[model samples]
Target: MIRGPVIETPRLILRPPLAEDLDGFCELMADEDAAKFIGGLQPRAAVWRTLCMMSGAWSIRGFSMFSVIEKSTGNWIGRLGPWQPEGWPGTEVGWGLLTLAQGRGYAAEGASAAMDYAVDSLGFTEIIHCIDPKNAPSIKLAERLGSRKLGEAVAPAPIPHTVWDVYGQTADTWRARRLE
Candidate 1:
């Protein structure tokens, strides 16, 4: 079985999803506003499936989003990390936090660690974030992470998303940005 690595940031612990996180994960995906840019709100059952999928991804792909735990409260705050399913647009490090967790810079902190792992550990040459055109917050976050809008592409259908704004930087660029 594949095991996820536990990654720690200044104020958060990035670890594999646990059964204890089900409620928070459900709440995040159930909120229309929270799920808007990522995907629309889903029923509890769907959310459970999603959680299982993320867990399964670790074993199947050896890499998946890390569950973000707030060090202060020990609560599950969100999930962010490397993700690349079959036929995915590209190697990616994505983020999605609870609505209450927005604007705290947790996404940036956790994602930075994930990106480092993607490059330095996984040996990925590039990383991308497939963002919806209308997601201003995510777009801003992508920019904050030194990723520029690379272009747009059609996502696989039935996902209800239109042309996606792909933002990314090469490994060299990522390293250079981190140094600055």
Candidate 2:
């Protein structure tokens, strides 16, 4: 098993995906609205594949989305962090959370820490978030993270028909922003 880093913020714990996280991950992806931007509603079997994919990525590439846990409740809330799947647009620090976890500023808090890890530890000089064009909430969050709209790009094979508005910042820019 991949022993990934355990990152703690004020209210959340970010760690690698585990077998036990399946239930919460399924719950999050089953909700229409919550899963809409991340991906359409996924069935249990598909969610299982996704969970395995994340785990496999950790084993194969040494990094993948972290299974997010709410510190106070210790509940598996969602997953978010470094992600660079095959045919990806760029090195990314993406996020997806359970519905109840939204509107809580948790994405920003968690994403900041993930971005730090990707840059400082993983040597990623640039980080991007590939967001759907209509995902205003995500667009807002990306902006909040100091990522500016870079341009649009067609999504990879599985979603090639979909075009995304890419937003990002270089490590130098990210570091400069952090000092402010």
Candidate 3:
């Protein structure tokens, strides 16, 4: 498996997924509101597969979402990071946090680090976020990250019925914004 880098932010830790994250994954997926935009609610068994998928992505693809851990509590709050599964529109940095974890700016903090990792380490030239149109909070976060709505794209199978608005910024734009 890919021994991915562990990133420490002031309030969070971004690290690779492991078997131990199953319970946290299930908790996140079980909450309706938290799971709504993220492929709807999933059962525990399916969540196990999700955890396995993220862990295996590290093994097979060399990158995937990192488990977002709250530094103070040392709890797994969510997963957010670089992802570009088969047939994805582009290299992307995505975020998903549990209900309790929302509104704390964790996604933004962790995602910014993930974006840096994607560009600096993963060699991504551009980054995109496939967001549902109705997800106002996510749209705001993407905009906060200096991304604009570039257009729309349908996600890969298991979730092709819905079209997602793609928001993005190039590496140059990201770097320039960071300097400002």
Candidate 4:
């Protein structure tokens, strides 16, 4: 089994999903607004499957999104990190935070840490964030992270999403951004 690493940020802890995180994960996945960009509201059963898929990824792929926990409240606030499944467009570091966790810069903080791990530890040469064009907030965050719109691509089927805006930067650029 893959031993997921614990990544600590200034105000968040990025770790593998635990069984206790089911409630928080389900709650976020159930929120229409919060789940809109990622995927529309999912049933509890679907969320359970997703949780299982995420945890399974660590064992099967040796990497997956890290569960974001608020350091102060010890809450599972979101999930963000390295993600690249079969048929995926490219290597990506993604993020999704609950509505309650919005506007706090946690997505940025957690995503930054994830990217660092991806490029430095995992030796990823490039990273991307697949975002819906209508997702202005995510677009802004991607830009803030120094990723520009590279192009558009169709997402996997059954999701009803089309022409995702792909924002990305190379590892060299990521390193330069860190030094700035």
Cα-based lDDT for every prediction: 0.89, 0.92, 0.93, 0.92
The predicted structure with the larger lDDT, 1 or 3, is 3
Candidate 4 per-residue lDDT, tens place, 1-180, comes to: 325999999999999887788899999998999998887799989998888889988999989999999999999999999998776789999999999999999999999999999999989999999999999999999999999999987887655656799999999999999889
1-180 per-residue lDDT for model 3 (tens digits): 336889999999999997888899999999999998988899999999888888888878999999999999999999999998888899999999999999989999999999999999999999999999999999999999999999999988877598999999999899898888
Q: What TM-score fits each model? A: 0.95, 0.97, 0.97, 0.96
Please give the lDDT score at residue 5 for candidate 2: 91
Model 3 misplacement above 4 A: none
What are the clashing pairs of model 1?
Answer: none
Measured on C-alpha atoms, candidate 4 has an lDDT of 0.92
Number of colliding residue pairs in each model:
0, 0, 0, 0
Model 1 ranges with Cα > 4 A deviation: none
Residues 1-180, candidate 1: write the lDDT tens digits.
226899988999998887778898988988888898777788889888888888889999888888999999999988899998777889999999999899999999999999999999889899999999899999999999999999987777556546799999999999999999
lDDT of 2 by residue, 45-149 (tens): 999999999989998999999999999999998899999998998999999999999999999999999999999999999999999999999999999999999
The CA-based lDDT of model 3 is what? 0.93
Ranking by lDDT: 3, 2, 4, 1
